[model samples]
Target chain A: MSQRSAGPELLRLIELMARLPGFGPRSARRAVLFLLKRKDQMLLPLADALRDAGEKIDRCEICGNFDTVQPCAVCQADGRDDGVICVVEDVPDLWALERGGSFRGRYHVLGGVLSAIDGIGPDDLHIGPLVGRVEAGGIREVILALNATVDGQTTAHYVADMLEGTGVEVTRLAHGVPVGGELDHLDDGTLAAALRSRRDVKR
Target chain B: MSQRSAGPELLRLIELMARLPGFGPRSARRAVLFLLKRKDQMLLPLADALRDAGEKIDRCEICGNFDTVQPCAVCQADGRDDGVICVVEDVPDLWALERGGSFRGRYHVLGGVLSAIDGIGPDDLHIGPLVGRVEAGGIREVILALNATVDGQTTAHYVADMLEGTGVEVTRLAHGVPVGGELDHLDDGTLAAALRSRRDVKR
Candidate 1:
């Protein structure tokens, strides 16, 4: 048997877990110990989860979000207005919007924006599919809820330019909040500024 | 479908998670949202773990610790000294001792101790097997590392009485920490006091 199989599996799990955010080696050890104590309640289930996800995770074909189901529930929901798609850089922002319970629209996940330094371009994201979704017809508004970063604005403008002749309304989320500031972290002032000052696409 | 399967599974998971120590409902909701956003990295594994552990958890037959295995690793380790057993009230205490890396002996998990007001008795704990283990052979000393609570002392005395004719050296952890004070929370002075005042079993 390998040295990996020699000692307790829980110890190895703790070592891996120690690398996670907010968990130092001491905290990881404590968490592992807690899981061991409540093995029935925590440890075994956690192990099963790790195994299951390792076997089954896949990205949604339409939005590039991780899900077991194809297209994912959000893409398939009947109540969501497909004609008014909210475009975001990642799925976390989509979920943040969903928690607010205000918007009842479909979403287009860009995966990430155009970053010249990172070598990311329009082809790297789901931009082609987003344009197709818009041009397919009946679509009115495309909300650019991307972050306020330069990359995010650049990506927004690039998408707007692509969709210009298609007669769809394109708008970008307002700036003033710091780049990479998640919607969840925004106070009402910043959230309101981002919401109320949302501007029409210039390109 | 059952009502259990009808509502949002993620919501239910968050509700259950909110009750955990150090987390409130808001944090639990945020955690669930975070998991959902990173479904591939966090959610699917967590879900599988919850299901698997829910199915396989059981208390250990010998030491009453929770584990999927019959005899837990600590209980089954042949390298541990059976001659010097450290007794503790809960698995958390056992875990603390394990982290300290000083003790080379095996442990006896009491599960709890004698509390007249709460109706806990010697029979309620694993005291019988403890005495049997001490008296059988090769065992030289029994460490009474129970809490400093009134009931803890009461249970310690009761166990000492049961081992009077056994001739095994029975000793208690010294008393300096107050009742309800956990070893995890104690300073060096208090922990050392508890260590130094350890007395011979007064049967």
Candidate 2:
């Protein structure tokens, strides 16, 4: 493995680097070497950043989004519609929705969806907190922006059932052909969904 | 770009991570998020490892390899043949050779090969120090274990020419079809080299 060639400390760095999402063993080695080469410019700054993030970044108390602040920027921001709440699978989904710049409401991050195979149930996700938010009143609408997967749908239905008597209007992202998608390349399931939920033309 | 969603520290971390060899903008974001998610297990350890490596790891005085020690592990190791020196293009090449565990000689890292197009010459490399090591007398043979590229060979020849009258026997890695390689998928140059350097089978 050439693990012994580079000292133990450097090898440890490579091992930890390999654990990162996009890096495998080979790429991790390359990354560690690159970091070593640019110690002043990259290595030191990254180390400092990681330490700072570990200390500063935390889950938002209100929305479950990650931020340095307790309530998170989205929850604390002014001029946003406090009446609507977008429920997403995780922080990344919240970030994706924010990147679109369309949704003006705050978000409630449901840590993950209900997965039967993975042993994840209602309690495993942030569904309890979500229901609590809706039950406390003031929220008029809740958008279930979960992924269009089997687990996601099951979780969405489960959440909807939980909020039945709460007087909140539940909605979900539309299932159809994606914007800029070619119908010929789409699966039969998506085509069928698009046909069933066909919207009327405004013109 | 949703860059503002994450705080300034995290955004800065992502920016620096994008400069790493294997990570691009998208993957850098994924990596940063992954680190943030696993703060105690992965993030803290990685940050500590980087800081340790940055503080300890430096170029070996004798061999030019990156190491926590002055002469590096390979240069300081006992039982290796001190009389034969293996010259390579970079630290990764040295690590690759070490992983193979075949060569028992020490190495001299050239840092880079001669590239006229890139303005890299002998002086830019550790060629003078290598010659000095050979001239000081114990080295009997020098193996040019560089890559089989045009620049690698040109650098090899340049190094050999510089050591002309030093009584050091200069050698290079033999060109052939790679071990366990199929003939059909082999390149023309490799097939030709394998055929021309055909060796007699021992009875």
Measured over the true interface residues after superposition, the C-alpha RMSD of each candidate is 7.3, 1.4
Candidate 1 is graded, for docking, as incorrect
Residue B32 lDDT in candidate 2: 84
| Per-candidate interface DockQ score | 0.11, 0.72
Which docking category, incorrect, acceptable, medium or high, applies to candidate 2? medium
Candidate 1 stretches with Cα past 4 Å from truth are A1-7, A15-58, A65-68, A112-128, A135-137, A147-167, A172-203, B1-80, B91-100, B112-125, B135-138, B146-167, B172-203
Off by over 4 Å in 2: A2-4
Residue-by-residue lDDT tens digits, candidate 2, B12-71: 888988999878888888888888888889989998999999999999999989999888
Residue A150 error, candidate 2, Å = 1.9
lDDT of 1 by residue, B123-188 (tens): 888988888787677888888888877888888888889888898889987557778888898888
| lDDT score at residue A134, model 1, on the 0-100 scale | 88
